[model samples]
Target: MSETENKITFEEFRKVELKVGRILSAENLPGYKKILRIIVDLGGEEREIMSGLAKHYQPEEIVNKNVIVCTNLEPRKFGDQVSDGMILAASNDNGRPILLTVVEDTNPGSQIT
Candidate 1:
């Protein structure tokens, strides 16, 4: 795709509320080997987010880790779980995925501008 087509307008980008979320809990989704259901604390409010990280991470590997989350995405139903947000990650061609994290410790729900 061309850069023009791939680029998003500032107004359109602003619609996504990207924030930091601290993972409170994480577990493998039943019968789903590639997915993990994680509960994240976004400061005061908590949200359940389902992420496909089991291929690269274990449940114990992500708990307490602060990650960037897209808080404005429309809820998605995967299997029996309803995911309310999306965790951001960077995946390389080797298929290794790394969760995006802050350089310094920051408060949960801190807006990423």
Candidate 2:
């Protein structure tokens, strides 16, 4: 069950480093049950993240799509990919994956809050 929302102060909210990134490439990682190895370009720098979105999107389909990422999180290694950030996405009632896309034309690494 989900808990009630806890609103935080601006100071607390500012600690989260949410940045925009463009998907440079995506490919199915062999041997994984259901994960896509994605490269996202935060301006000029590229970072990798393993997303369990393969069930909803083909690897090549999401290329060039700008996405929001939690960039300040600790790095995690999944298989050969070192995941540096998390790709934000939503789940439907049935749990289908939905990428959290940018509205308007936000620049890469733009502050979301």
Candidate 3:
């Protein structure tokens, strides 16, 4: 496979509402092996997202970290919980999922385009 996969039209990409958000709170969702319920402050209000990053970092470590989230993604049911958005991340050296983080001190709900 090529380093880059097949290209997508700009229009197609635009459909994904990639928004910047701040982690306001994080808590382990009971009974899940790798899920954490995260509340993101998206400027106007907060959105809840369930991400599987508990094995890599403590909930406290991710609090206040700005993140890129796909807000338009269809919410999925995890056991009994619904994930409203996707917390973007890349694989770590050990192939563990590491959520993408922001560095420019951008405000929550900032458009990523």
TM-score leader:
1
Q: Which lDDT tens digits does candidate 3 get at residues 1-113?
A: 67468778889878988889999999888998688899998889788899988887788989999999989888998878898999999996888887787778998999888
Off by over 4 Å in 1: none
Candidate 1 residue 23 Cα shift, in angstroms, is: 0.6
Residue 35 alpha-carbon offset, candidate 2, angstroms: 0.9
Q: What is the C-alpha lDDT of each candidate?
A: 0.95, 0.87, 0.88
lDDT (10s digit) by residue, model 1, range 3-113: 888999889988989999999999999988899999999999999999999889989999999999999999999888899999999988997899999999999999999
How many clashes in each candidate? 0, 0, 0
lDDT of 2 by residue, 1-113 (tens): 33546767889988998889999999987878688999998876888898898888998899999999988889987776777889999999989988998878777777787
In order of TM-score, best first, we have: 1, 3, 2
lDDT score at residue 86, model 2, on the 0-100 scale: 92
TM-score of the candidate numbered 1?
0.96
Model 3: CA > 4 A from native: 1-5
Clashing pairs in 1: none
For model 2, the stretches where C-alpha displacement exceeds 4 angstroms are: 1-9
